[model samples]
Target: MSGSLRHGSGPRSLSEIARSGGPTGSGSFVYDEATLRSLISKWVALADHYDGSMRRINLGAVEPPGLDFASEALSKSANTSGTAYLKYLEQNYRYCVEQAQLLQDTLDDYLGVEHQNVTELNKTDQPTGSQSGI
Candidate 1:
């Protein structure tokens, strides 16, 4: 296989071995479709994990404050911590949304369905499944 493809040998596809930086003086590289798909899938999974973690942290439940004195005592800390957590969660959520959109776009491009309609249509002239001559 090494004799077949090598870097700087000639033009190759995006998913082709271009170079290999090994100690044998002959480096190896991979530009294959499987590698690209795996990379994209990993990125999507990472984004999902980050989003899930953020949600779990932000949605943690704590008991409500009681009397005025007790409320005041905990309010300051809760407010500060909650604010920080909320901000972090918001940032992660936005990042996740962006990643998801990007992934969707990639899939659409791959499947050639970016602008295709995905709805059912009713035709008065057409017979129903049971009414068909078949």
Candidate 2:
């Protein structure tokens, strides 16, 4: 087939390669129980920073560091791109957490875009050459 994604029996594109999964790819995360436990424990205890930031924001003692100086009305009105890191982190709470579930979710999200790109490329210039592998 002119635009065939599968070349013989092997992964024919980056999308396929990623979907295949491996030790570092997706499902095949090969960490020992102790390592995974240590990581998860560290991840679970990550909220101390949140406590500090909340205290700072609550006190209104100072604008949380790195946030550009602007009045609330102006900052709100502008709808600026590139807000402070803390603010961005606060907004994306789900992504901020370190967990195995997020890995596949994130990969699937980007894989859609990659698949689209591969489709577009195939449409423009479908390879005639046969690829070889198992």
Candidate 3:
């Protein structure tokens, strides 16, 4: 049989390669415990900056320092091939932190929209009986 006619022994398509969960591909990149810890720490710090009382008083001053520290640590640790993994971890960690912030912002916007809708509904001069019926 021709090579292309093979059942499972032939090379995979791009989509198959992309979707595969084996080694020698993106699947090989696993998030280690240290990376998870760094990600969680960054996310908590970001949430604190956005919602903590001290952050509110300071107007978001705390987040930059934490981000800067993370950047510096990543740069310092990215020297050897073993430590080179830190660079990827750092990038992923920052991306996760940013995603968390975006999610929080989206939720806040949704809540504001809902609150406004409720306020508008309440402010209408409709009959209490009709409104209560709904």
Query: Comparing 1 and 3 by lDDT, which wins?
Result: 1
**Runs off by more than 4 Å, candidate 2:** 1-29, 59-86, 98-134
Model 1 is weakest, by summed lDDT over 10 consecutive residues, at 115-124
lDDT per prediction?
Answer: 0.46, 0.39, 0.39
**CA shift at 81, candidate 3, in angstroms?**
0.9
- Cα RMSD for candidate 2? 18.4
Candidate 1 per-residue lDDT over residues 24-72, each given as its tens digit = 3456454344543445445445555565677677433444477677776
Q: Which 10 consecutive positions of candidate 2 have the poorest summed lDDT?
A: 113-122
Candidate 2 collision pairs: none
**Candidate 3, 1-134: lDDT as tens digits:** 56665556522532232234323523444433354334434564443333333223322112222457776565445444434444445565456445544333333343343312222322353344421100
Angstrom error at residue 32, model 3: 31
Which candidate tops lDDT?
1
TM-score of each: 0.40, 0.32, 0.26
lDDT of 3: 0.39
The true-versus-predicted C-alpha distance at residue 132 of model 3, in Å, is 41
The candidate 3 region of ten consecutive residues with least summed lDDT is 55-64
lDDT of 2 at 95: 36
- Local lDDT at 29 for model 3: 41
Backbone clash pairs in model 1 (N, Cα, C under 3 Å; residues 3+ apart or in different chains), count: 6
